[model samples]
Target: MTCSRMQSVVIPRHFDYRVLKCKVSSISVWNHLSVHRSLAMNVRRLEVLDERAAGSGMGTGDQTKEMVPGGISSTETDLEDTDDELGMHEKHEQYLLDALSKMSHLESFAWSCNHSPISIDLLWPMLLKCHTLREVEINDNLVFSPVTNDESEGDSPNVAVAHELRAVALKSNKHVYGSAKHPDFTRVKGMLNSCPNLESLNIAYTQPRSLPHAHLSADDLFLFGRWPNLTSLTLTNLRCSPSTGLDAASSFLFAHLNLEILHLDMSPGTATWYNKLVFPPNCLPRLRELKAHRDLVSSLLACPSDAPRPLEIIKGVRLTQATDLQQSADAFFFNLRRHGVNVKRVELTSWHEMEDIRRLIESTPKLTWLDLGKKGNGNHHDRLGGSGASSSGAAAKSSSSSSSSHFSVVNANEWAILLSAAPELTTFHGVKFFYEVSLQAQASIANAANLPLYANGSTGNSNSGTGPAPGATAHVNLNLMNLSMTDRSRIRKNDETASMLAWKCTKLRRVDHWEDGGGKVVVIIRDCGDGKEKDKVAPRWEIRRVKQ
Candidate 1:
């Protein structure tokens, strides 16, 4: 579209007869706006050239030269014509300003690479006219940070206009936090405190902890004095210590009320330090979720030697490792138990074969959901002896019972204790076995279940029509993860006896197996309540979803 008698002009491709007379009346507008097609393309090429020169901290003029070819103006222009219309209703000047103030739907604002200072100075006045601004999104690509005069100490033009925003996001040019020796994040921090309605923030991939004057520690959390309405908070690489003003943060939450979620992603080594500070009962009155890496959980519960603090069942937790699995698990469980907190669901990951599922299960009695899958290819084992033994072992010597309960890394032995002890369990999950559990051993386990006593390969008809036998309710639900196609095929091929024996336990509801080639094999659940016990395939059971 051509403008009136401008020296440089971007002409419209089609000139209709109706506007020809109007175009001729303003020849100066055409001359002033006369921009050649080649010049526009050359300016586009300069984008990359400018980027390279900025990387080298060299002359921006040289970069601009590389942007345009021959006959290009060397000086930057004072005026820029973006020709953008107003965003909100602009029927009248007052109506437009009023619409801006009342527009609550506005969530983000960005002004990068669109206009320069002279044009920006005009843009801010128009934006400030928009009173409805809630969020300001400033992309740092187009010199979003203002050029400050050392002597005047004046603020950025956009910063002055951003006072009404509730949330501010400053996506920097790079992940320069902590790495930069002298970080200049003026606009970054300025917008943070500017918005009175600001409650949540996310600083993507920056090492803010390493900043000299602006770094925030756990201690600073108390300075804000508990935001009662604040429901969520997140921090990455925020350096914090166990002794750092836990009472103050807790007091803030208690006083203001209604705080629910807290997320801290710190150094891997010091991640768990926050767990050590126990929230006094009802301190975080509305808290429902706490998320941290495994290392953090370990650090929080590391000092089991100290008085156990009651950490109620948070809605969710993501653990990161298995090195201190049992200790961490025990501390988490015991802490929650102190407040009689019953978790409705718990999802945890481990690298080793979990030996502490029993303690974890018994601690969270209200647990309706449990997932104990391994993250990497690691196996963990629990201590052996009385605690791991079968019910009958209690009649034997306590020492024998202990030994029976004590899990051996040996393949067949641990299954014996686990199958017997975990009878009332609703959901049992584990990684695919590293070694195949023999069919004979598996059959023996099935025979030892709630089923009637029978000799090998023999139907015990002698006890036909007998009343319910002792301990007849023994049913275990099992879920398996990380099973390769080869491993599953091996079990199907090598352990026909075990599969057949599994068929005998009518109460077995579901078996989720990660069959190697079969993908995830979910054996249809079966209801084995029929009087006539058949040796054929178990019938498919119906699954009913009940609301909690």
Candidate 2:
């Protein structure tokens, strides 16, 4: 194709000039945009994320130099190489600003490169000038605090606010989550003032516990006026003063009845701290996805049985230990069984037992994704002995049950049984699952699954019988960090067992083996045959899309 034709076809209306490497030729979007100056007018969304310098190759006769106005051959522009990096950066910043001027029709803009010489404050007027712009996001990547309102405003004339903006997200440096240091609140307030009717807002601000700010509390989240269009709110790394009481955030939630998605990260305190903050029941009728602390899960799921929540995904982070879950475990699960009936995905960093997993699968029949937590140690024996086991027979039964139910790690047969309970589950993360380690156990599970045994007593599948199509592929990513080589070797992925699992749980696609020390290993079921011999060698791509 001709260069002009290629530009017309390849360039998208939504452009992301984000690069992780400093070697994107000129290390700026303008040099690349210079290649297609006409295409800039068509851009609707532009994201310049993690922008960096081009390093040593700047003065060379590179493609970027040829595409951009001032090349190495141009006598008008004098730029140094690695010896004078600052001069090159200054030249590129000018080029970047020139490119931004061309994108007059841009509707969405995001700037996340804190290291760039360009200040986000400088970009505000340029972006707000775009009459079509509606959404904006800024991520702080700098070492210092953000510019204050007065500092940001400087001597620039009063620019008209973007009343048409529908979404705004101002994020702080994410590395420090539980700290007082946050992005400049004054600048954030000024930005919020510009857009009053936002449909979505994400502001992560935390302050010292002593001098509590209402911005972290119920003062309409510091908005100039109510935002009736707000449907999604993500507030993280927040610590409201205890003196402010539990109603600080909940009161805000009560007012926003139209909210569909909410992700709140409060101070990681005790269960009592979590339990004290009640999730006002019979509210947020439109809530679809939720992520909050674990102790408050029961209350969040405490919506009326008749008015069950339509939550498709629910994620919880445990504040305390396993003993917290030991309280009314059955009833806690019963609530999940009720309100979570419509749920398709469950991710809990809270403690879980075999019975807990079993109760979960049996409850959420529509479940396709399940993530058990890594917080609890296996103390099943202790729980059994202390729960008042009277007779030896009961003890023996509890002993057998604990082996499958209580162990932090479980065997393949036990996993197969648990999987059998939820046939629809395709993706599973968390917990240690080992297959092909115990031959006797494998044989027993194979027998129970009614899998056909060959002459050698091997259960390797030959037919696709109502299974994954021929040459089908699945992707798994598991990280097994900080495990002894012996334990790691034991978890060696056996493809045959993975196929057996695929046959047992026919829809199974991906299994993520996540270890506590932040390791992952993914196992795929591949090359499943159609049981036909005529075209054994021909390759065919059979793709299937599962509904989420």
Candidate 3:
């Protein structure tokens, strides 16, 4: 029933019944008449790879017949005549169509063919007979043409209703390149309209390829509104006109209030579309998660004071290239804060400044998960933290004074201040901290002296000393579940300091220190309740590195 390397299969002539389920990469319908008959009669679910036609009965001219005693070759000419009678392409197409026609009771069909294009004219008529079909996936090259006068209209009552169809995916083959040939947008739209009750659609291309000149435009995408009950929609590399703004697109999307997730990778040229995108208040009431480019995020943030809706999650915001990263971030965060929007999760796919991080923590008080990690890039050392801040001139002076040093390290003192700001933080990833014994010593001294660390009520001494102050202890109450850091050697060298830092986090569980070249040394910390008086006493903590 399950196979990975099966090239061909044969069914005996006596097997005249149906196949309830059939999954195969290649089928030799031409070579085995009984197999073809069996498949045609009873395939409820059919999945095929359709890599190439099998058993075409064609042989290379290199096949030669042995000369008999009379110097005559008999079999070669006979084979050539047979091959000429049944052309490879024609035979293959006919056999596939015939097999499809036999499956009148089929409910689902999936074809993944990347080698060659299939004519929809040959497949559509067969599908029209499977009125019970519910799902279809065809990831291949499909040549589409308009219906002719002799053919029935797509929406005619004579056509199969396909009322049970709920999902369809018609992604293009990855091997097809250039914009020269592509699925007709009109035909694709017509096909989608046929699935009246479809709820989920994913037409995203997996690989890079230029779309045809007549690709879907902003207005064409508005056809999505036809799927009234649609819940999830994903379209990648969709081409749009430069003259068309996001207003139309947003209006169309707003009509789909039931959508829970919407992901779009608009054509690169449409990056400027964000400038015109708008979200009216109370729009997309059920949309909780969105994954798009920075433009969409910027557009949402830039909405009129009375027009924006509260979103639980907004991902793919870019803050790296902002003229004033801090100002831009503050504006974005403050806008959300002013509107009383309680976005619990935010993901920035670019570098963020230290002040921006501070503003983010300050604005999104209910945020539990924050990810500022760079994707697809191995270098983690260049992340902006507290190292290069001009405001931290005194701290920078003690370290490398060179302006060329790009690595920003958030020392223990800075971390205490930041972590203290965000109490609800549970998962923090992709931030590097500079760990050193001297910084910990300063923090210890400040705590012992009962000196206020910063104006923010943080307790950490900036003055470095030989050891911890007498009766000095570090304590913090937080709900942090995971913390990821870079620069391992520094953390390893200051184990005592790191331990002190870890001890303060009451709900701390795990720490990840990433190496420069792309490996992580994870340290797991478990809170073992204080023995004998577990309820009344604070829990004791244990820390150990997880072996690779």
Which candidate should be chosen as best, given lDDT against the real structure?
A: 2
Tens digits of lDDT, candidate 2, 1-548? 36976675554432332211222124344644544566566666665544342333453433212222222232223322445767666766666666667777777876656455555566676777777788888765331254656775583556567778888887655333222344334445556666767889887654435434423332335333357778998876554544444565566666787888988766554335566665666677788988876546667787553466668888864423356456745556777777777888888665435666677778789889877654354343322211121322211222112233232333444576677778788777664443212333233323433423211122233343432233321111111223233322333334334545655675666664322222434444444345464223221111123332
- Writing each residue's lDDT as its tens digit, candidate 3 over 1-548 gives 26423322323221222322221212243223223455455555655554443322332221111111111233323323234433645555665676677666677777655553445555755785677787887765442323445543534555455677877776764454322243335556657766778777777544325433434354565645467787777777665554543556777777777777777766666766754566875566666677777546545555554444556776766666456455545566666566426677777766546666677667777776777765223254544343433223322322422332345545545554665566666555565443221334334333444534211112222222321244443332110011112212332333433444454543333333423322432332333234553333222112224433
| Candidate 2 least-lDDT 10 residues | 472-481
TM-score of each model, in listed order:
0.44, 0.63, 0.60
Q: How do the residues 1-548 of candidate 1 rate in per-residue lDDT, one tens digit apiece? A: 25564423333321210111111112122222233332222111002121223322245543222211223242222222223434211222232223223323233444322222122233334454445555544433221233346612644445444444555444334423213333333434444434545555544324334443333344443545333345556555444545655565556545644545555565444445555555444454454555566434334333332333333334224433356565665566575444334344455644233345555555565554445544343333321122232222212223212222223212323443443343333443342221232234335434544343221112212222431243332221111123233333433332342343234432233332322222332232333244564333233311123222
Candidate 3: worst 10 consecutive residues by lDDT?
477-486
Backbone Cα, N, C clashes tallied per candidate: 42, 9, 0
Local distance difference test, each candidate = 0.37, 0.53, 0.50
Q: List the residue pairs that clash in candidate 3.
A: none
Candidate 2 accuracy as lDDT: 0.53
Note the residue pairs that clash in candidate 2. Answer: 478-520, 478-521, 478-522, 479-519, 479-520, 479-521, 480-519, 480-520, 481-519
Model 3: lDDT to the true structure? 0.50
